[model samples]
Target: MRSPAAGVPDPTSAALWGLPLWLWVVLGGIGLFGVFQVYYWVGHRLGSRLYASRLGRRLGQDNIRRVENAVRRWGALAVYGCFWVPGLRHTLPWTAGVLRISYPWYVVASALGCLTWVPVTSFGLYSMIWGWLRLAARSPALAAGVAVVVVAAVAVLVLRRRRRRRREAERRPEDTLTTA
Candidate 1:
């Protein structure tokens, strides 16, 4: 069912077993880029740990300063990498100034990283799928296995962080709970 790496077989060329090739290509690109960006942007802008109001004020000034230093020293790669790194992605940019990673550089690196990841993911999918289909005459269980692994990994990360936060909260005295 999957198309080639470009996302779909070229509409102008390949006519296969289903919808017109042109429509699939156009829709596929829009779905991939548009939907992905919106999801990423929403997460970046308002995820609980990272929203400006939360981390910006809660951590006071010192931790923010360390973050600012990290940004300045490493630039956009640091910010872009944060997306996959969970804690940073949600909270870093809000206090990025405290970390001192320049906004301009952060934007450039984040955009490039986001842009490249999509095409690369799509292309890799195409290669894997094409190989699977050609070699097996029908794709096997590999893709399903990959999906399960990715989901399980993400779940483990989310649960681990939540557990750590809960344990830390429990250790704090009733009044000291205000600090983290």
Candidate 2:
């Protein structure tokens, strides 16, 4: 909102902390891309042993299998799509490396994903936080209510997902036994 001597609006006036919002978004995107590269290399180095590692066990075999299937089916395109999927974003990169998908294609897809996804999420999150702050300034009680509602919604979603996973786990053994 502030302007310099030349009457041009200062970009840093809208910044979070000392850096501009655009700078933060760019850094975040670059950082995420770098992490993806590391995941790919580690998976490539581990090869099949990745599935037996501590991190892999933590991720669970079922999750790995699902990621593997995505990579197998979609190849490089899966890398871009994964950016939009919370769970698959981290897992699919590793699987792609293990499967040895073309590095050049993988780089292109991941870069494109970073370019598109980062700006949208960054601006959206920025708007949400600033809007909440402005609302809080106007009415403390209303802001508190909004916060509580958002938390409750997230909690409900998490609980439902956990219950569904538990039920599926319980049924898996029965399904295997019946087939056998």
Candidate with maximal TM-score:
2
lDDT of 1 by residue, 1-180 (tens): 335674544425544367565455445555544443443455445543443454355453445566666666676666666555645654555445334445567566656655555455555665565555554444447656665787899999999978976676566534222435
Best by lDDT: 2
Candidate 1 ranges with C-alpha deviation above 4 Å: 1-52, 55-66, 97-100, 121-157, 173-180
Compared with the true structure, model 2 gives a TM-score of 0.84
Q: How far is candidate 1 from the true structure (C-alpha RMSD, Å)?
A: 7.7
What lDDT would candidate 1 get against the real structure? 0.55
Candidate-wise lDDT, in order: 0.55, 0.84
Per-model TM-score versus the true fold: 0.45, 0.84
The TM-score that candidate 1 achieves is 0.45
